[model samples]
Target: MPHFNSAHTQVFQNGELTLGLMTPFGDATHDLADMEDQFRLAAMADELGFKALWVRDVPLMVPQGSANTASNLDDPFIWLAGIAGVTKRIALGTAAAVLTLRNPIHLAKTALSMDRLSKGRFILGLGSGDRPAEFAAFNEDPETRAAVYREHWKLLRSALSSSDEQRSVLRSATGGFDLMSKPASDIPMIVVGTSRQSLQWIAEHADAWATYHREDARQQGRIGLWRLSLEQKGASLNKPFIQSIQLELSSDPDTATEPLELGLRTGRNGLNRYLAGLKTMGVSHVILNLTLKQRNAGEIIEEIGQYVIPRFPP
Candidate 1:
């Protein structure tokens, strides 16, 4: 495998935890209308020393439930390209792009193009996809998504490989079409969720692993499992672990934490301590989704940038 790209190294240092922001930051219903403001805040985050900016891939507005009602989301590649134009250094990534639903050739081309456009600051996060409606729309059977995921993953990896041996193998298998463009460096592939695979599979194939937020003890246990998987696979134990959280920052800097569904409502101090604990437990990065209902997103970002990020420098 190729070495870590610039973005991967910047965001996933072993024994350290870095912070990133989730893009399209506002109430889901209003995200499309808030694009200009979103870019402005994205630029602000870049300046404020955040490590990366992540965007989601929601191909259709499939309402999964009351909590997961689809929002108008921009295509992850296009959105990240726009963000790349606005920011200089902060890494740009997909929280995950659905691998089973996209053609591997196109996906590899787009990822390489984005990596070039971002000047080597792109990370490719992949998922097997979870929504049955999305699978049906793509004329795929969700029942076989796991097998599809593995197949697509192999094809995508072969397409993206810089190794001459790998490239030759890919060409022989595909009967000889070239990818045409090359990445600035290796593009990091982080497996988001299980993608219907075992921990051992992820540990063997992924550059890193990304998962959702959980309680501290549960998260620690998950990290333990990840470590054990890496050990069992003879992979690097330093391979990073990532998690995302929905944050509602309180006005008072010292306010105590209150748990939300997959995140927390907390002040700067509480947030700092929580992130510190994550670092100790082996989390390499945390993506913050600012669920701002009562404060300006910029204000909360600025607060986190000033008070929280400084303590956990990338």
Candidate 2:
């Protein structure tokens, strides 16, 4: 198999945890996000040496559910493509692309095009999707999604093969044509959550793991579980583990951490200490979601770049 491209290797280095910024890049207090501001935030993150920038794949805006609640208002691929053009080196990724909703051939081709356009700097984070309304809208069976997920995953893997021989091994689903534009090298694929599959299945197939962030103690246990699962198959888990969290920066340098939705509210000092603990617990990358912050998004990014990021330098 071909190795992952330079951006993947750089962001997921062994024995070190790097930071990434999730898009919409603003406080959650609002309903709308500006496109120019989003682009500017991505550029700043790249300039500040953040390892990656993540965008969510939300195909439909659910009526009153969480989808309609937040400011994630763009197609992840189109948005990431815009960011890729302006940024020089920051890795671009779909926090996850919902594999169940998209055709595998389409997913594979679009991903390859993005990787080529970005010069080998795309990470394909994938998931089975959690929204029931979406499944209904697409006329897919939510109950049988696990089977669909597995089948489509196999198709995508076959379609995106870096070797021409491997590409030819599987005939197109229609048995009528050959897929084109294999990635320049393997695009790193991070399986998100279980995607309704077993741990062994994920460990065997994924290049990395991107799961939800949790308290340090619980997260360590989760990583331990993954390691044990891989070990049971007589294999070592050499791949990185990644997580995404919400962040709220307080002005006081010594402010204590308080509980929030997916993350915590804390000062830069507290944030640094917290991230250091996560790194020590075996997390390889932390994707920061700036949704619930009270400070100006730009200022918070700058402060993190100046203070917190130096402690966990990429």
Candidate 3:
């Protein structure tokens, strides 16, 4: 809300269409042992002309939750670094990192190192943790997650941006300043969820705002809130309104209105219609998750690259 370019304007000036993969790590259908599948798929995404690759900071997944079977995975930072050496054209970003569960200083070190390794291609996504089980195992409380989350995000930002004189007070540093290289700039940080964070807070401190599974009809009002918050703060941002959606483009083109957690269970027609509505609602980018597909990730990728992206917002 303070001062940043909206992701919408930034995206339009650059390229707007983006694709997110929930890394097919534990799929029993294929050889799940391929640890590098994420990297390989990321590279393939870039080669196939995708804009960015989204990774996540998932440590523990709720087995019965909507994400129950989806998360047979690890920390996203590891995956980010693994693919950094290979990916060139596509920017790397996170869906959201559970900051409340990590040591602030350590997390900062990882963020800086990943950005440096990627040559300023990293976008840090952070969120308040909602998983009580994860909080319990780590000796954290769900109620205090917001506080911890803010504290860690601020600490990480300060560490990444501080000079030697400013950082001298921390008792310890990862790798003693030289262990992990620093990124070229203050790597952009994005906020995940509403998080009880005010518009003034977001406009003043955040680089972008991320929402999940918003209905098509509601895009305008949602993005308008973000924009109004930015305007009210008297801040200028090169920020954009970014949202993630789930889609199932079946073999049939007609839309199917079915029940879904954060997205629609629709075919190509509904998918396009929804996306078109988003474009009109002033959304700059949408990270599509094809986890609802009846087919494999490779097949899903092909379907999108050939059919969906070609018609993205101008």
Candidate 4:
């Protein structure tokens, strides 16, 4: 059965650091994740105490190039539902759910329903859709994501807030329409990347910020630039900062220490060696997904939980 507690709810509230795993395979274009493993691995991640398992919302990965996809390819939500039934505590999240592709009504229902199943453990992150091909499939112009995303984001918030009339815009036209099962709390919405909107808007509206993985030189630059934005916007809350890192944790966490796709292919030890540096560099959480990784994903997870976690236990 699904379990809920203050610890799960507090993943967003303070200086908490969390980890996430992307799907278990790699992509063709841009090398983003395309295929993923069967649900069994994800359930294992849950038992191991991973904060979340992120799935990509890639609709079309360059079309005709489907066969080249690395692993089992299917709709992410299907996988989420399957994983939900098996795991008790882990969160099912997208590195971001591209709001521009999905209909907001359906998405609201899906997220809230998942929260109910997980007993209020859903945390949603979104961004202006990045893949142009995906937006095109929905008959949407890639350039129009900023406007559409802002509207959808606002509408979802209102619909999810109250079970009262007038505030309900999700299902029926009447205001008092309530979503079948609203989430226990304001389901967190973290914006992944900048959408050309004001930093103030993100600060005022976003529950947290999700950013990309950067090497040392670029990492400092990112912290500087984003901190400037936060300072300029006069942001007050201790909004958490989460980034994704692709790693290859082998039997020896020391042997793997070179850059791979968007991340390094370092052994578990090398990965941990750099984490303290990252924490000091102002990253609140790091979701290290060995997805599309070079080594065994399950072995990596165990190694991380048993050996690496003791050093910098989240």
Best by lDDT: 1
How do the residues 202-233 of candidate 2 rate in per-residue lDDT, one tens digit apiece?
88887888888787778889899888877886
lDDT, candidate 1, at 76? 88
Summing lDDT over every window of 10 consecutive residues in candidate 2, give the lowest-scoring window.
63-72
Worst 10 residues of 4 by lDDT: 1-10
User: Model 3 segments beyond 4 Å from truth?
Assistant: 1-19, 25-33, 64-70, 162-182, 255-259
lDDT of each: 0.88, 0.82, 0.65, 0.66
Shift in Å, residue 251, candidate 4? 3.2
Model 1: weakest 10-residue lDDT segment is 26-35
Best by TM-score: 1
Candidate 3 lDDT, 24-93, residue by residue in tens: 3225233333656656767777676666677666576555454455355555898777777878866677
* Model 2, runs deviating above 4 Å: 27-32, 63-72, 169-176
For every candidate, C-alpha RMSD to the true structure in Å: 1.3, 2.1, 4.2, 4.6
Model 1 segments beyond 4 Å from truth?
30-33, 65-68
Alpha carbon deviation, residue 122, candidate 2 (Å)? 0.3
Residue-level lDDT for 186 in candidate 3 = 57
How many backbone clashes can be found in candidate 2? 1
Q: Which candidate, 2 or 3, has the higher TM-score?
A: 2
The lDDT-based order of candidates, best leading, equals: 1, 2, 4, 3
Model 1, span 1-314: residue lDDT tens:
47657898889887999999988886665447366788899999999999999988989888765576676888889989988999999999998999999988889889988888888899999999988889888999999989999988887777666666556645765688777654546688889999999999999999999999999999999999999999999999999999999899999988899999889999899999999999999999999999878898999989888988899865
Assess candidate 4 and give its lDDT.
0.66
lDDT of 4 by residue, 198-295 (tens): 66677777766777788888987877666777777777546667788866665654585888666777776787777777777777777775654455
